[model samples]
Target: MAKEKIVLAYSGGLDTSVILKWLKETYDAEIIAFTADIGQKDELDGLEAKALSTGASKVYIDDLREEFARDFIYPMFQSGALYEGQYLLGTSIARPLIAKRMVEIARAEGATAIAHGATGKGNDQVRFELTAAALAPELGVIAPWRMDEFREQFPGRAEMIAYAEKHNIPVQASAAKPYSTDRNLLHISFESGMLEDPWFDPSATSNEEMYVLSVSPEEAPDQAEYVELEFEQGNCVGVNGEAMIPLEIMEKLNELGGKHGVGRVDMVENRFVGMKSRGVYETPGGTILFAAHRKMESLTMDREVMNLRDSLNARYSSLVYNGFWFAPERLALQALVTESQKNVSGTVRVKLYKGNVIGAGVKSHVSLYNPDIATMEADPTKAYNQNDATGFIRLNALRLKVASGVEQNAKK
Candidate 1:
């Protein structure tokens, strides 16, 4: 009988590389390695050769940058989803896209199972498995870190390194660099290892190496830089008046934002698995977009509509963080978000300097901001009457006056 086949989400990293070899030896399974190119920059270099040398039967690398930004990143950004008001949900958002591709590959290759290198303790495992279950429940999901047998065989990074050495797997991972990192077009995140200590200050010289997509705020140029962003129906369409594709827009913003030391966040965030993790992230492009998008909305969106959307921002963000991208609630919420963006078309100028994204100016053809009524200087012909404030304030103060009288009676 032919050996059972399994599709492994391979990143050519230390953990995944070791998993590839271990799966082959332990299960006697044919390993089909799949790597999704979601803008990992130089990380993809020599990935195919390394996977095949490490014991993969057939390796596949697909470029999903455009798809990732257009479908996953853009929609999440449109909803203004931020996990705990800090993280942009970078790694969290990428997992579903990766899982979706892994499922497709498994079906195509006639594989019976799909495997990932996410540890049992982290949120990625949940994200990957939930996506798999939602998309292809019939396929077996294999998580080595969660299994007792796999954990006993390789207790930690040291044991995994030893196994890799024995199996002749070529990997650059070492015990010296304890922290692990995940990177993509959206952001780069660092956690575990040295970052575990919540009191540890990463601003020290030792932690300088953790940053990849941005520079230190002190190192940024003294002068501020300004950039204009164009949006159509809540999607960024151009930068500095230059029209570009989704991928190109991200690349441009990342370069500009990185140079100005924008988008650096450090916080202890609550993971879906009932634990809090300290993580440092660099999300240059995302930060720029977030600020610019809000500025555009201020100009174009109505006050109450924006407030209603803001009320649901936390719930929307929670759904994304908890790996509910395919869930029904998220889809329904997205519909409302999309509807709210129908008139959110305009250009916003943002000033970037020393880790700050400040709004400079914003304008829209359908802007609701009326200078005639809002200006401090009284306008004789303006529709807004200053006399109307008397009745409005009196009516609003009625409830407070009644409550004060009731309190006095109780004291008496």
Candidate 2:
């Protein structure tokens, strides 16, 4: 009889490392660890060696950064899917890509099961499992955190640390500095530990070391810098008049925005799993793109089209946040959003100063902003019809006047 094989999404982090070793010991299976490289800035360095040392049979580190930025990040950015009005969906967007790659590796390795370290309480477990279900339903999902044996064996971080120590696994677990963080190209998210307290005021110096993206706004640069972004069909293609790929564009904006101390958010949001959690995020490129894209839409998109898209933005955001990336509702809504952006070609000039993203200007070839029609200085006979407005206003306000008259009659 042969042992079953399972592919685990390995991050070389404490939790995933411990999970890797535990899966091998508990399942008596050949555990292959897979790590996706999504612009983590050398976080993947020596991950294969680390995974091997942590008891993985064979470690696979796939550089999926280009594909991630091109296929997933770009489209989501185009749709302007900001989770819960503040979160940039950084962790949300990265999960599917990672999960997809994990499934691919599983198939390649001929694994019967896939594994993840996402806690049972977080939205990431749903995101990872849903993606795996959509991509490779036949593969059994081995979630150790959800398993009674694993949960009882390692009740907390301390137990996990003890297990790692027994296995001679290298880990960063300690009594102090217990906050958890996830980082990728799109954004960095901080949660758990110290963030559990709603009244903790994340801005306080006690948590200053937790912020990876930037310092406080008070420490930001006093000078403002202007940058121009070029959009084609709602996707940002160029920055400051230089054409660049999706990933390059993001990198450029992130550098510029980070230099100026942009895109830091702190909020307590309702989780899909019936709990409120405090999350701090840094989305420099996303912040710039959102402001610039909205500004471009103002100049290029039709009034009714923009209004319709704006109405659905919240729904779309919710779907993405709640782990419905491959769901039909999100696909249908994305189709509508895509159709509306057909003429969203423009350039937006934005000023980034400290923590502010101010729109300086926007222009497009399909611009509906007619100075001739809108200018008060223009001749009324040319494009204006003052006479038509009298009947238009009267007809629109007739219901209000009738309601007022009825109130007066009732009073009399």
Best by lDDT: 1
Q: Give lDDT tens digits, candidate 2, residues 1-412.
A: 8788999999988899999988888889999998888888867778888998888888888778778888888777767777778888988988988888889888998899999999999999999988888889999998888989989998888888888888888887775776888888888888878778877777777767667766666677888899999999999999999999988988888887777778998899988899988998888888898889988988888999888888888888888888888888888988998898899898999998988899899889899898878887856547777798999999999999999999999999
- Go through the candidates in order and give each one's C-alpha lDDT: 0.92, 0.86
As for model 1, its CA RMSD to the true structure in angstroms is 1.3
TM-score of 1: 0.97
TM-score of each: 0.97, 0.95
Per-residue lDDT for 15-96 in model 1, tens only? 9999999899889999999999999989999999999998899999999999999999999988888889899999999999
- Where does model 1 exceed 4 Å of error? none
- Mark the 10 consecutive residues where model 2 has the least summed lDDT: 207-216
In the predicted model 2, the residue pairs found to clash are none
